[model samples]
Target: MSWQAIAKKDLQDSIRSRTLWATIGIFLALILLLSWLFTDGSGEGTFIAAAGFTFLIGVLFFIPMAGLLLSVKSIVRERNTGTINLLLSLPHTRGEMIVGKFVGRSVVMVVTVLAGFLPALLYIFVQVDEAGFTQLLTFLFALSVFGVMWVGIGIGLSALVNSETQATITGVVMFAVLILWPLIFEQAGIELPSFAQRFWLFVIFADLFFLPGRIADGDFTFPSVVEFDEVLLEELNDVAISVGPHLQMWFVVVLVAFWIILPIGIGYYRFSTTDL
Candidate 1:
């Protein structure tokens, strides 16, 4: 079959599955419920921030789940069912098959994100009058990049692992890294003298790895209420030392390039060499 045909079939199969749609539904419901509970009737500062935070949390959960569920079986299921051999026996190249699967799964992820988030955008515009529309758009754009990176990581793991169980576990661990790292950093009190400098450097390197420049930049903001004065300057200095003005854009670009290129290259390499 042609590559287009393969891609189309994969897309069709994904759409027919309930997993993506159900996940999107859950995300939307959670966002709406949180907004209702936390947002004031007038929808002002705290409410808007709450809405933004809620959506951010939802995206974090949804992206990895979507990536893992959509991609974990792309190749392994075929092998389990003895279809991988038949597909390899065809005239199609391994590269085309791998690309087709990635494109298909990535499309599913993009569609699900839009489905879950677009209505939230509309609601914020109509109901919550506090946040600017541009802010929501900017946040969503950053989130889409985050989702895409997770999807790439999931596909890469799926390609490398031989068993479905192993692939599922790998995907879950990767998902945990994507979701839990920030929380861990927050709880560890990176502002402490011993941890401050190292933490800032680690944060920059993570931003370079994750391609989320806005998140890294936002991390530099001082808390609204500070209890300790002595460590504040030192902490801010460490953050400043971690990411310089000139390097921010370059770091984001390089990270994004690597995020896009490395996974597909590695996945294709693994798929090409593996015995089908």
Candidate 2:
């Protein structure tokens, strides 16, 4: 069998997972409920507003949780349970297994992101006056990339570890670094150089939440924290502007490429050399 066959099998397995379905169900329900609770009834630019709310909740909570849940144990579980031997008995190499698992799990995450954002799309399409389809599509594409990045981290962590426990601990640490560090930095008022702050924000997918309305409206701005105190938001804007070309949108490509490639590459390296 080839890596394609492994990817197909993994996809089928993920589709059958009750936990995956449950995560999707909860994400969809919460996004809709939050949209209802948070959406202003003024009906002016409601689509972007509602989508902003959904994206915030997803970025802060659901997307990371689901990504970790679906991928963090992928390779380690197979190794621990002796399925790795059976898989190797096939014609595929170990590299194919790692690639297949990452691709398969990444597909699962994309589907989860799509399902989670369907409610936001409902609001977007309903507000056709200001709801630029291009904007929504752009933000959704960015959101998918963010979610897939987490899947890569989880899969990489799984492959690097030898046990389920190690995977779990590493997953928690990864989540904290990716999801909580920015919040800590913002809340504690920690000082960093402007360029470093912008780079770190993008690293944690903060820019995706920070610019949802701009992204949904197709008017790009330097992304900053807009959900918090007005004064802090202004400060962030100033810093964002002062950083100039150091933190361009193209830098997002560089960071995403680094994150997606480094973890998987490291994990593949470890997996390739380790005795299975």
Q: Please, what are the lDDT tens digits per residue for candidate 2 over residues 10-69?
A: 998889999899999998888777766655445565456667765677777788888888
Model 1, span 1-276: residue lDDT tens: 556666787899878888777877887787666556555556665324755566655655665577678777787777788877877687778777777777777777777777777776666656665666556666566556656666676677777788889888877886776556656766987544322322232232334333333454665322211212333765877643333432333345445556656866787788789886
List the pairs of residues colliding in candidate 1. none
Evaluate residue 38 in candidate 1 and report its C-alpha lDDT on the 0 to 100 scale. Answer: 55
- TM-score, one value per model: 0.73, 0.81
Cα RMSD (Å) per model? 6.3, 4.5
Whole-model lDDT values for every prediction: 0.63, 0.75
- Which ranges of candidate 1 are over 4 A from the true structure? 1-3, 46-48, 181-246
